[model samples]
Target: MPELIAPTVRLHAAWLEAHAEWGPGFHEDGFGLIPADEVESAAGFAAWVARLGDESDPAKAAKAGGAACTYRWIVEGERVLGGIALRHGSGEFVQWAGHIGYGIRPSARRRGVATWALGRMLDEARVLGMDQVLLVCAADNLASVKTIERHGGVLEGIRNTKLGPARRYWIKIDLPIT
Candidate 1:
């Protein structure tokens, strides 16, 4: 079974492979948006991991221009299925960026990886004391819309973004954490 794990250099090989498979434009939303070039080498990946660690602290995260968040990779043993991030608080960009963002590799799509990962991430958010969570996705991303809906996400509305139209949904997570 896939489980959430802290980012570690031990998964660098799998991380690189997944990123390569996704090609350009692969969104690493939960990962502090680290550029592809920054993680091209082992040392670079290690540095990126350390940076993510720093960003998890509230003070450091604010200094870096965001709220405190925990980043975790969805993996089963050595294979990385995907990644998810849970932001501790909603900031000015919450309407567009939402509290959580995730991405599953192309090879892992349509296999319920994203759905399962998201469910787990929501649970993580609950543990962090969030009563609910906001999720935004591209208006055209039907799969993501369905995934969010499956988790009881209620459509809040759609708004224009630099990237285009985005749909916003709010998922009440006050119930028992799954």
Candidate 2:
């Protein structure tokens, strides 16, 4: 079984193993990783992890003038499977990037990891009082399209983004019946 947990430096080596599996680039969508983030060294990885936590802090987000985001890694025991992020703000960035982003390691694909992690994040979104969430993926990515649709995502259309054509979807969060 997979579990969703906050980013931690204790999984440094495990994360690198997952990172390497994706090859070179800042394409680990759910990790909030930027090209400038130095995650190769222990100190750097720790700092990056700290920054991820800070991004989740409303106070820090207010100070930074950016969206508050929650990041979680999908893991089974000590092995990192993938990552998922739920953005808690609506703006141009969120509109273009969507409220959620995720990526599974190449080796871990087709095992329902993305589906499971996305469901977990939607639960988190519900807890945060989000009525609905947006998710955008490459139009060519049938796997992601299916995953979004499986979670009750409604098509919002495809648009040409800076990253290219993307299929945008919105999933409504069903509040619990009292």
- Candidate 2, residue 7: the lDDT equals 98
In candidate 1 the C-alpha lDDT for residue 48 amounts to: 86
Which residue segments of model 2 deviate by more than 4 Å? none
- Candidate lDDT (C-alpha), each: 0.84, 0.95
Residue 130: error of model 1 in Å?
0.9
Clashing pairs in 2: none
Query: How close to the true structure is residue 112 of candidate 2, measured as C-alpha lDDT?
Result: 96
- Model 1, position 170, has a per-residue lDDT of 96
- Highest TM-score: which candidate? 2
Residue by residue across 109-160, what tens digits does model 1's lDDT show? 8999889989988888887778999999999999999999999999999989
Q: How much is the lDDT of residue 77 in candidate 2?
A: 98
Best by lDDT: 2
Q: Judge candidate 1 at residue 95 and give its lDDT.
A: 55
